[model samples]
Target: MKATIERATLLKSLGHVQSVVERRNTIPILSNVLIDASADGTIRLMATDLDLQIVENVQAQVEVAGATTVSAHTLFDIARKLPEGSQVRIEAADGKMLVQAGRARFNLQTLPRDDFPVIAEGPLPTSFELPATALVQIIDKTRFAISTEETRYYLNGIFLHVAEDPAPVLKAAATDGHRLARVTVARPDGAEGMPDIIIPRKCIAELRKLLDEVDGSVHIDLSPSKIRFDLGNAVLTSKLIDGTFPDYSRVIPTGNDKLLKIDPRSFEEGVDRVATIATEKTRAVKMAVEKDKITLSVTSPENGTAAEEVPGDYSSAPIEIGFNARYLLDILGQIEGDSVEVHLADAAAPTLIREGEKATALYVLMPMRV
Candidate 1:
């Protein structure tokens, strides 16, 4: 394989695909990226970890139509260090690949392209195109709640499905037992009968990065077991978690009537300051809500105590609740509006949070004893 590509363009494409390659691999080919140069003036860079794969195509001057495999990290590092505006020449022969730019040169061993494992995408029947902004909003607002526990593999991703909250809406939700995040957007044209699927955490994270550089919309194709995302020149295919997500609707409380509205920025700051004195394990903070103010306090045997009063609008009967300070800050960070609404039934029941009264994003956090 031989091709010539700009340093910046090559580096960016390599950066996208190489992230799928594992640093430590039992199979040598899994550590390398497949470089395919076509006569039509483009080069394809593909990398995979058996479960997830990313293929990126970049415009280049192709001199030969051939394919070869080379260390993904090594090529990325070389391309990254090349000077700006330099032309990169890549050629493979005699089981080695040569990379040259200006005065720097390096020869790296190549693996046979046939040895690379390809995750077969059987048939993705469910396909839809959604605006990139809507997709980004769904991921950014909920991914923080994805679980990392290995045993509950089903909870390690975001649950995506269409919902009928009086009308059809596309929803994405994630939870780690302690906290839950759910965001919804108007249902798109082609997503009416789509099946519910759990998108793994790692895939959500990697896909999020790609979406940052993309505009317009993204094409998504999926089956019960796999999903494929087409973002212009880049395509990402990932295996879905083969497990059932819990009935999240049952966990979302609907009878919480007490309402307290507070400035999100002030509440966030107060929670952060008092959390410094909270225990390292629990990170608990106590909130004593009155008619006009909410007092946040924390106590730790090793770190002493701290307290701060955040002004809020509350007219219901007074209630005291304890919560994990870190979780409170996380939900607060996602509130984009000026005011944050906290609906409470009591200290033991789960607390519901949202950005004012009409926000599409909803967060539920379970309280912890202080």
Candidate 2:
């Protein structure tokens, strides 16, 4: 449509909404962005890939109000390369668009706006709001565990549900048969007694991208078949996976007696160096704890072996455990403390890890039979 918008403001919203449009699509218009300008100095942008859709509102100077569909990536590229704070002038006529700002000028071809798809509307009955920071934390902690195995469609998304704990809570969990990660946060106001929502992996990734610059809260609304995230200027909608997530509570170890408290960095670095010699298929690093020190080692006939020691404040019975080096590194990345406590019932059982001062979040790892 015909409108004038500030270069920086237009780029920000376009950057968020344009990501939803895939470069290649079965339908031609699906690769383009729908731009609608109103007489009230506001512009609406829409993009979709049939299943997922995004709608965003941006500020603009409306001249001749109308609508058009153009290449989202191409427009974004042109706007980004233009001078900062320059006023961009856009006009649509005769199936062509003329873009001008400062000394630069671009003429882009346009597609019919009617061909662009809008995500179907759902009568979402359950709605709630939560702090954007809290949602971001939950995603960061558990997204690493989401299964990429497409054959098992049920395990492809984060399981968001009401946790059965002393305090009412909501949790998100993911596992790929190798390692499991679950994060629980107290339910916020308006979110009281909300039904569980299992969001797909792509949806979580898209929603997380929008939250990076947001400071206020995000409004969450869900229908039985769809989920929508309202992040002020932008909105993300996705179809939910019609399958049940496996019960994660049962997998968490209930009784772990021996505890190993060691500096998180020291432990992480030791495991990282030793795992270099281990086989790529099984990057297993062995942990041997005795008296008051924890020794990490990996032996590979092809590349020799590596061994190192990390001091700990533990005098409990010694234990030896083998784990995937990558899994341990994932959990360590989420840890925010100098020391981390590892709980073990036995070398053959699952290992539980928590911050010395327990984080609002916790994780348990199923040990490998090394």
Candidate 3:
């Protein structure tokens, strides 16, 4: 393979594809990226770890049309350190790949292209396009709630499906047993009959990073077992989690009578200050809500006790609830509005939170015993 590409362009493309390559791999080919130079003036780079794959295309000057495999991280590092605007020349012959730019030159070992595995592309029946901004919002609001516990594999990803609340809407939800977050947006065209799927945690993270620089709409093709995202010059394909997600609707409380509206900034600050004295294991903060103020307090056997009062608009009966400080801060950070609405049932029941009474995004926290 022989091709010439700009240093910046090559580095950007490598950054997108090389992240999928595992640092330590039992299989030799899995650690390398397949670089295919075509006579049509473009080079395609592909890297995968069996479950997830990323393919990126960059414009380059192709001298000889061929394909070779080289260490993805090594090539990325070489391109990253190259001076700005330097032209990178890559040529592979005799099981060796020569990389040269400016005053730097490195000979990297090449593996046979035939050894690289290509994930099979099956027919994907459902197709839809979502605005980049909407996709970003969906991921940002719910991804933090995704469970890291490997035993409950189904909860290790965001649950994406279409919900019909009089009108069809696309919803993304994640839960880690202690907290649940749900966000919804208007469903895109051709998504009415889409099957519910759990997008794995790693795939969600990689896709989120790729979306940072993207604008316009992203094309998505989905099946029961696999999903493919078509970013303008890059394509990502990932396998969906096979397990079934729990029925999250049942967990959301619908009969909470008390309403408390408070400034998210003040509430967050109070929680942070009070939790400073909380036990390291629980990190729990107790909230005592009254007519017009909420008292946040924490007591630790080793560290003393702390308390603070935050103003609120609560007229219902007083209630005391205990919650994980980190989880409370996470949900508060997602609140886009100035005021956050807190719905309380009791100290033992789950509490609901939202930006407003009719907001599309909602959060539920299971209270802890103080």
Candidate 4:
């Protein structure tokens, strides 16, 4: 295969697909990206790591119509370091791929295109079109809470399903024993009766990258075992986790009636300052809420105690709760509004957090004994 592609165009396309290739591979062909050139002025680049695959198409000047494979990381690095506006000419000859741009030239070993594994496409039973912005909002607000524990494989991904209560909505939720995040958006067209799916953590990350570059609609196709995303010039497919996510609705609190409204910035700053004295292992911060003020304090056996008082609007009886400082900061960071509303039952119950009056996103954090 031979083609000439602009450095910037090739670099961007490679950046999108190369990330799927693993750095170390037992099968040599798995490290290479399949490049196919067509006479109609386009080049297709594909890479995979058994479970996940990404394919991207970019405009190029094609001199020969054929296919070849080369190391994905090496090719991406070469394209990135080339002169900005220079044209990159690539050709396969004598079991090697030659890359040339301006005064620099390099030859990389090539693998037979036939040896590359291709993920088979099957009939997708459900399909829908969703705005890129909506998908980004759901993933960003919940991905942080996904469990990293390997033993409980079911909680390692985001649970996506539809809610029909007050109104129809698409929801995404994630939890790790310590905290949970849930977000909802208006249901998209053609999403009715869609089966619930658990999208793996890696898939969520790759889809997020693709959405960051485009502002159009993303086509989603799903079946019982697999999921696919069509992002205009790029396509991503992955195997769905083979386990059922727990019923997250039960984990969310419904009877936490005590309310505390405070400026998010002030609460975040106070938590940050007092957390310095917390021990590295526990990193626990104690919060005491009274009529008009919330005091955050951290005490460590080796380190001195630190406390900060922040003004808040709370009329409930005095309550003291202890929580992991890092977990509190993560939930606070996702709040977009100036004020945060925290619902509490008591020191032993899980606290519910939300941004102002928005019901689209909510967080539940478990308390730790101080």
Candidate 5:
């Protein structure tokens, strides 16, 4: 196929789709991207790893109506290094694909289009449309908790399901063995029959990137085994995990009443400073709250102790808790307020966190042994 596309635009699109393509492949065509050109000023790009797939459509000035397959990474690299805003011409030759822009010419290896694996688009049983911001919020809240353990394969993905808590709501949750993160939102009308799908971490990351550019909404496609997202120019499809996620609803605390409101910046900074002396294996920061102050301290057998006292709005009975410094930082990164609310019952109980705005976002962290 002969097609003329702007180098920058084509490069960006290739970079997005090519990310899913694995480098060393048993199947030769798996590293190549399918390019189809039509006389109607449109060119489409598609790539897959068999388990996951992405299809993108670009507006190109087409000269000939045909299709071909070329190396996705090589083409992307060549276009990106070219002079800024140069027009790129791609044409299929006898045995290779030719890439030309101004003074630079690249002959990239190609594979037969027939060898490319194409995942048939399944008829989605349940479909819904939601704002990109909402999807981003759920992912941002729960993705950090996703387990990295390959053995407990079910916990390696974010669980998206409808649960009856705080109402019949849409929720996402993930956890390794140490900590758990769960977030719930009121389900929309179209989500009535939304099947519970476990979305892999890689899918969440790619979807997050695409959602960044979306202004308003996104279409969600789901089957029991797969999930698909349709944006304006791009489409993402991922294979869902077949196993079941752990029952995490019972893990979140409901009776923790004592609350400590401390400056998020101060609390975060104190933990950071103290954790510097903490051992790498533990990374524990201890918190002791008094009348109007919260003290963060850390001690290591080899290294001396480090401590910092920060002024807070703590009135509840004094509470001392131990937590991983890294987990505290992750929670603080998502909170957007001057003061952070820490809900506690005792040292052994899970600590609930909020940044004054309860409806906005809430975080719960398990206490670590000091």
Candidate 6:
């Protein structure tokens, strides 16, 4: 294939498609990206790692209509280092791909395009569109809580489903046994009766890259086995995890009676200060709440003790609870508003946290024994 593409355009598309290519591959072609040049003035780039596939189209001047595969990362690096505003000319000759830009030239080995695996596309029965910003919000709120444990593979992804309680809404939730994050937004059109699916962690991460740059709508198509996202000229398809996600609604605390309202920034700072004395292994911090004040303290036999009191609006009986400092900070970081509402039942019960008065997003953190 032969084509001339703008350096900036090629670099951006390469940056998106190359990430799906794994660094090491059992199959040589798996580490390469398929480049197809058509007479229609566009070049199609595709890369896959068996589970996830990304396809992007870039505007180019096609001199010859053909296809070939080349190392994804190497091509990306070459494009990135090329001179600004230079035109990149690529051509395949005698099983090698030549990349030329200004004074720099590179000859990369190529694999037959036929050897590259293409993910099969089937009829996607359910399709809907949602604003990219809203989707990013859901992912940012819940992604941190996804479990990294391989044994319980079901908890390794965020669960996406429709919620129909007080009103119809789309909800995303994730949990790692120690903590849980749940976020809801108004359901998009054509999302009703959509089947619940567990999107793999890697898919969520790669999709986030695209969502961060685009302000347009994202078209979502899902079936029983796979999910696809179309954002402008780029398309991403991923296999759905086979395991069923646990019912996350059961883990969210409902009867936590003690309520504590405090400034999110102040609480986060207090926890950070007291956590300095915590042991590196456990990193546990204890919270003592009484009246209108809450004290965050950590005690380590080897590091001594540290405590900080933060003023809050709390009227419940005195309660003490231990929690992982890292987990507390993660939940606190997600709070967007100044005021944070924390609901607690006792020292051992799970505590619920919310941002301001909005029920759109909530966090549940399990207590750690000090």
Which candidate achieves the best lDDT against the true structure?
3
Arranged by lDDT with the best first, the candidates are 3, 1, 6, 4, 5, 2
Which regions of candidate 6 fall more than 4 Å away from where they truly are? none
Model 5 Cα lDDT, one tens digit per residue, 1-370 = 7889998889889989888888988887898899988899899999999988999999999998888898888887887899998999999867589898998898887887778888776778888887888999988977887888899989989998986665678888888866777777888667876788799988888888888878888898788898889988999998998898878767767888887888888778788888898888889999998888888999899999998999988787887889999988888777767877888888888888877644545677889988
- As a whole number from 0 to 100, the lDDT of residue 258 in candidate 4 is 93
My TM-score estimates for the predictions, one after another, are 0.98, 0.95, 0.98, 0.98, 0.95, 0.98
Score candidate 5 by TM-score against the native: 0.95
Pairs that collide, model 1:
none
lDDT of 4 by residue, 1-370 (tens): 7899999999999998889998999899999999999999999999999889999999999999888999999999999899999999999977898999999999999988989898886888889998899889899999999999999999999999987967898889999989999998888888889888899999899999999987888999988778999999999999888899999889788999999999999999899999988999999999999998999999999998999999999998999999999999999999988889999998889999998555689999999999
Global lDDT of each candidate: 0.93, 0.84, 0.94, 0.92, 0.85, 0.92
- Regions of candidate 3 where Cα sits further than 4 Å from its true position: none
Question: Model 5 segments beyond 4 Å from truth?
Answer: none
lDDT of 2 at 18: 81
Cα lDDT tens digits, model 3, 1-370, are: 8889999999999998889999999999999999999999999999999999999899999999999999999999999899999999999999999999988999999999999998886988999999989889989999999999999999999999998887999999999999999998999999989999999999998999999988999999999999999989889999999999999999999999999999999999899889888877999999999999999999999988899999999999999999999999999999988999999999999999999857889999999999
Question: How much lDDT does candidate 1 score?
Answer: 0.93
Q: List model 1 lDDT by residue over 1-370, tens digit each.
A: 8889999999999989988888999889999999999999989899999999999899999999899999999999999999999999999988999999999999999999989889999999888899888889999999999999999999999999997877899999999999999998888878888899999988998899999998899999999999999999999999999999999889899999999999999999999999987877989999999998999999899989899999999999999999999989999999998998999999899999998656899999999876
Listed per candidate, the RMSD to the true structure in angstroms reads: 0.9, 1.7, 1.0, 1.1, 1.7, 1.1
Model 2 C-alpha lDDT per residue in residues 234-295, reported as the tens digit of each score: 88889888888887778788688788888888888888888888999888888888878988
List, in order, the clash count of every candidate structure.
0, 0, 0, 0, 0, 0
